[model samples]
Target chain A: MANDNGDDARILRLSEQDNVVVLIQSVPAGERLRLDGQELVMAAGLDLGHKLALRAVPAGETIVKYGAPIGSATADISFGAHVHTHNMKSEYIANYSEDDPYEAEDGS
Target chain B: MINSYLRQDGRKGIRNVVVVAYLVECGHHVARKIAQPFEDREEHDVHVIGFPGCFPNAYADRMMRALTTHPNVGAALLVSLGCESFDGQGLKAHVQASGRPGELMIIQRDGGTRSTVEAGRAWVEEALTTLQGTPRVDMKPNELVVGTICGGSDATSGLTANPAMGRAFDMLVDLGAACIFEETGELIGCEQYMADRAVTPELGQAIVDSVAKAHRHYHTLGHASISVGNAFGGLTTIEEKSMGAYAKSGSAPISGLLKPGDIPPKGGLYLLDMVPDGDVRFGFPSINDTEEIGELIACGAHVVMFSTGRGSVVGSAISPVIKVCANPETFELLWDDMDIDAGRILQGEASLEEVGKEIRNNVLAVAQGTLTNSEDLGHQEFCMKYKRFEPIGPECLPA
Candidate 1:
């Protein structure tokens, strides 16, 4: 029962405890979002293939993708503040952790 | 109903090919000349396959031997430049050992190009007549090995085409046929999940370690972004892309993990690690689609199931590639280029089982000698580059 206009928009649950829903299609600013059969006004524009917060998130919280924890957030993120590189960091070993002494010494 | 052209080795080939193989690129002209004589034959089975390098290496020798004696090949004419590092005589002997007729037409010793061409033509003509006389047999679906790969992927790849191939792979594996899915670089993040689905715990660890090896290989080489399409389609990290790419393997228990050129031990899900084991040189793992197909053939694949959202047109020298288009829009744009429209799954026009059934049917038909789009277009491109692979660890091959 998702609608693009001012009508009720259906929200999708990516995971059981995930406090977010993915915007299957684009949603304009000020449009009302129907989440868990409850209506919540959109705080901002949401693009397709992007996620939106289902509930208010605290500063330094976890962000998930594909129903798995991708990384944590740095600052207090609004219900839909585009959880991305600016907010989340990789849990996998990458360039961000390039300064470890063990890595530098192993030199493999 | 399943008609197959039987080869001399008692193996049935989907196609009977008069393989015109050049020992080295130097002898390519003579090989082409040999193939010209049988250009208009009823079987229409002239294919040009060769290695450009004249280097001595076990990998190269093994690859050439496999290609020359591939299932689709019924007869061969090896055109050598008379002084190359490739073991031309050994190739001929191997071909002869398989009971298929093979002749070494040395360009330097056979009076140069023109004479070699004529002599090559005579050789091919004789080989063809002998091959034509081989009896046709009935090939069963269980005896086939179908490998799948997805290149030029985009957003729709996972939702439509990849899952569609997974459904088909499930059907193929259930029928007692072997199925292979590869490109370890593409399968980065889902390693743990995939390994957990392995038939044995040891295989699961191997799957995880294989991706770890690939991550290290690509990271060290600084070409980690070879998966550019995923980023273009809005994937942020390698793990995200890996999660998506791993779906192509379906929900089947991975029977084994294999490196490039290693055939599946038995028919089940196999992961072919496309990245080189150490140091990661050789320019790029695969220059294009044909190189991937060449590697699949080297690993004993009779046919490959190619899934693509962006669409691909290349095929292999010894195997028929069944292109499965993942995007409905791409399929609409390139319908002729694709063999199966997996995009229909998204439109609700076709169920996952329907497309899966179609892919399985197409595999059987192709194995029975139906030419695919790549084959019809004469895309006989081949490339096998140099690389060193430490044998896959015991965990990877827990039989």
Candidate 2:
């Protein structure tokens, strides 16, 4: 699927098993998109290359990408809502905060 | 068909580079200064690569030998501080035995930094003249080894550049070329999937175990390889980035496992285990992208295909690096540094198969001595630090 311009591009679904679709271009809040014959509205401004939930996800549910669980949502995520670190947490390592030093512990 | 410089060990090199290596931190300045004058010249290509530790390590010694005698290298100059525990003489001897010109310059014996730099420059000039007479032979595609590493990955990486890289890797493997994809720590989430693609069930188990080892090692350090930059770029977790990074391997059955500097016996796909064996004494397996690229070079890769979503402008000292841009936005911002626009796959201007073909053609052009963007920009970045490892087991190399 080729998109001629960023203003009219569609979201990309990587796999049939993936629970989220990635935006090919940034979309502003209130923009309406149709997928699988159903209309969905962007709840917030989403940046390019960011993931949008394909369906409503309950709090604590795992967010799947590339057909594998990447992290769990911290709160209920609605369709077309951006899925990122602010709403999801890694199952492996804790996310870095502003208080942490930027360098690795060993300091190279 | 490509005409390449034929080394004594029945290997062909696309470029005849003279590398000046420093054995310790003290000698790095001298080595760099010696290479500075030749860097701007077109006829003579001089590169500086070295280890900074004063402590003796077998792994470092082996890596030094492998790099100096690499198929693409025709001559070597070893710079050493007087009291460092590294075996500078042994490395020089190995290079000479490979039918390449090798020389050693000790800082203290040569009257300190200024004199040693002057003396090393003189040696390199003579070495370049000697390398000019080296014979060239017809190099086949099967005679080449190619490697891939992903950096600055983002959400677009998994969709565009990496899978396109997989397609290129699959094509190379089909042509009997030795292809490698590495960073076991980055392969944390895809271990089981990777194991299933191994040539042998035993090798598959070994793949799984290696990732398990990396998991435990990183846990003790209280940090994963996932960086804050990765999070900012839309990668929320290590597993998320791993699924993208693992795509560079393509669908070929893994032929064997390799440690740093262990050359593959035959042509196929291989995995370079970057994590240290025994305990995690080296801090992190690789401090940056250059270390990973360095290990790939030591393992005999003639060229590296580096996929970047956020845009990395670094290259290597020994082999050429082809940068494949993953994000269309980043490509727009850094077009000069990128060689291929796999990001076009996202823009709808190109298909994955089309970008894959572009990468394959670029690889052939680079193997035929065309300079990649990184090479043209004079980005000869190199780094190798102290690291400990045990030799590979018989099971690791089943071929």
Candidate 3:
């Protein structure tokens, strides 16, 4: 949980109670990382600023960040696997995408 | 100490800018034509800001009044289409009452677009000359009102830039500066944490209640506060994006709650409620980043610290926006748009404390007439939309 690499290293655990650690840099699929006195390999490539599950989280469970519930998992999330909108959803409001905001512009 | 323009309202402003406002969408072209001649000139600071709504709205009217008489503005020129419901006369009168020079030109009353543009240009040209005589006074940190907003955010925003900004907010609060952190909609999950940090129990309850109201409102409106850019930048959910956005407020005990156009009563920390009060009658709380930035300026922010990871190239019309870049990659790409690169924390080059001090010093430097990247690039973006907000209650600010 401690690192001399930086105040925040390439992967950072923002709080002790947080169940996920955030990536400060992009990690490849075969990359190795050490957390909680154990070594784990990345299952897939993820970009910088993505999240990695610190431990296995079951579907329907709350996803925790900054020691608080950010939302809920839509599917089972494996440790060191990529966590994103594909696998998780906002609990307060529906999560969807808009391709073009002005789609109905008087239908002209 | 910063040498700043002094307003008769006993407030100090970092910039003495001339503003040309379009009362409705019809007047927009004429207003733009009046201000376009001075856009590239460093000597003349003329900006165009307006509301496009043709229907009369009390919220829009108040916002115009607040912005036209903003401490940073030395004079204002209001252009009206004359048939719109907006009260252009009332807006100009309010500006003049605040001791700033103001003028109104009705396009229908004055000849057409061409004549109104000529009149507005002549008025602004004269106003710029008169603004040269505005008095400059010695101002301290306490007199400075700073506002924070994180836009185009990513996962690194909370870890690197936001907390570093939090550290800067702590330092500014200690210096007796009034700093504001905003948007209850983005702060959905962190309600308890904020409530615990309030100065009083009632204030804490008010803080929690405001978040609850935001949750209900967004749920009713059927739109999430989390933008598509946030998801592409690796922020998954609204709560996840919100926790990152909320970090700019820092650990200061919140002093008060404010709606749009409400000035801070004293020097301390404040939470600006960007959400409207009643049912979701209007559209989204803020349509874009420029609208939020304009609201912060209307609240009397002398300067705004805008932290970004996806990269926003915007600056407000009245106040200079200090862009704090959270991602090193984005910083490299948007070098000309950013002011401070806080991604040093992620790269192991600088700690959060070091970056915090850098942001604090940058705020002071920009306040002392050093132009920010946006200010230098001629980005005076402004917008206002219709919304409803009831005045805050007593418990929101405990003496």
Better of 1 and 3 by DockQ: 3
Better of 1 and 3 by TM-score: 3
**Candidate 1 to truth, TM:** 0.82
lDDT of 1 by residue, B1-399 (tens): 557777767776777777888878898777777777665554457888887777766666777788888777888888889888989999999999998888788888879988888877777777777877878887777777778888877676765677668878888889877788888777766677676789898888777766776767666667764345444454555555565566577667888887766767677888887766555556566667677778788777888988888887777777788898877888999888899998775554665567878988888888877778877766666666665566677777676
RMSD of each: 5.1, 5.4, 5.8
Docking class of 1: incorrect
What overall lDDT goes with each candidate model?
A: 0.71, 0.84, 0.84
Residue B332 CA displacement from its true place in model 1, Å: 2.6
The runs of at least 3 residues in candidate 1 whose Cα sits more than 4 Å from the true structure, single-residue gaps closed, are A1-89, A94-108, B36-44, B226-232, B346-348, B351-353, B391-395
How big is the positional error of residue B43 in model 1, measured in Å on the Cα after superposition?
A: 5.1
Chain A TM-score of prediction number 2: 0.70
Candidates 2 and 3 compared: the better one by TM-score is 2
lDDT of 2 by residue, B1-399 (tens): 878999887789988999999999999999999999998876337999998998888888989999999999999999998899999889989998998999999999989989999999999999999988989899988989999999987768888899899889989898889998999988887776677889998888888777776776676678777787766666777777888888788878899988899998888999999887766677888899999999999999999999998999999998999999999889999999999998887776786678888998899999998999888888889988877776788888786
